[model samples]
Target: MTEAAAQRAGRDAEAAPSLLYLVKRTEQAVRARLDEVLKPAGVTALQYTALTVLERHDGLTAAQLARDSFVTAQSMADMVRTLEARGHVVRSPNPVNRRELLIALTELGHRLLDDYRRPVRELEHRMTGGLSAPEVDQLRAALDSAWRQLN
Candidate 1:
């Protein structure tokens, strides 16, 4: 290769940020902040996410919850078990499908979510504290587009 081409390649390799690295780093940072914020409530970030999903759409099966929460079915099963033991959620046999178990948030779960709403919202606001509203929207759009690209 020519000297000019070799230099350019080295510069490109050193200067360009990996998209995967950036995404993973951002996720880690967010999760760390969420863990700190949610610790007092005795909920991990994944558990909180699952609870939020259940709050939005009650009566989801464990497998469905796993899909929605981006976790493995086994992890979801364990989480469901924990939630059930804590009385935050209950599972019942699906009437339409006896083989499937439908999971629903109990009244305690609803109340717990209500308690978490403000703190989590504040944490989100803090995460985007530097961004204007428009910038936040743009960031969301860009991230969503990137996510869609993977599919």
Candidate 2:
């Protein structure tokens, strides 16, 4: 490479701000904190996300849950197995689709979800703690718009 191009590349790496990098870094911090909170209960960050999906959309298939959380079906299936073994979820034949299985949170899962509710809310509060409600709302809307545009 030419000297000028090499210097420009070095400068870009040193000073450029990447939106993708910022988003991933913030997500990693939040995930680390959440994992710290959930680990005591034998829950992983990925499992917690699966549980959150079940809470929002009960009776979702493992495939559906995977899609909801940006995971592969195989990974979600493994998580569902772990959750099932822990008595936090149950899997059954999909009522309408004979070939597919449906996954749902058990009563134990519901109770566990209720039990750990505070930490998740606390995490969100911490994430937006410095912002006023209006600012938070605006940020949310902007994020929603951007996500829709990109995705």
Candidate 3:
């Protein structure tokens, strides 16, 4: 290679990946691990996320659940249908807002969440195995701050 091209190549080799790239890769890895852990229970990582949100805050609108689950409204609509069909969630008309329906976890959903809680915790522990607790907290805070800024 020409000297200029060689210098450019060296710089490129020493450069770290962008934060966006690293974050995407980390998300993919987490999703894959969650899928592996949840597959036996017949739930996707996304579905599990929605269920967990409901476990914490019951009777949220579909849009609210979608936002909490980090999915699009349309995607949440379909997910709600599938989850409802599978007896994981149910939708009922909002008592205060008759036109809007609220989604809530079913008994089966609670049971499934309970069943996978330990495995999910183990997955998180494994993912943060090398990081100290403070580092993990820092990572979480950084990510949350980035997300808030982007939003």
- Which residue pairs overlap in candidate 2's backbone? none
Score every model by TM-score: 0.89, 0.86, 0.88
Write candidate 1's Cα lDDT for 1-151 as tens digits: 9999999999999888888888899889989998998898788899989999999999999999999988999999999999899888999999999999999999999998999899889988998999999999999999999989987
Q: Flag clash pairs in model 3.
A: none
Tens-place lDDT digits, model 2, residues 56-118? 999998888999977998998888899999999998998799889899999988887887899
TM-score of 2: 0.86
Q: Residues 33-149, candidate 3, lDDT per residue (tens digit)?
A: 999999998889999999999999999999999999999999999999999999999999999999999999999999999999999999999999999999999988998999989
lDDT of each: 0.92, 0.89, 0.95
Against the correct fold, how does model 1 do in TM-score? 0.89
User: Of the pair 1 and 3, which is ahead by lDDT?
Assistant: 3
Q: What local lDDT does model 1 show for residue 36? A: 90
Q: What are the clash counts of all predictions, listed in order? A: 0, 0, 0
Number of the predicted model whose TM-score against the real structure is largest: 1
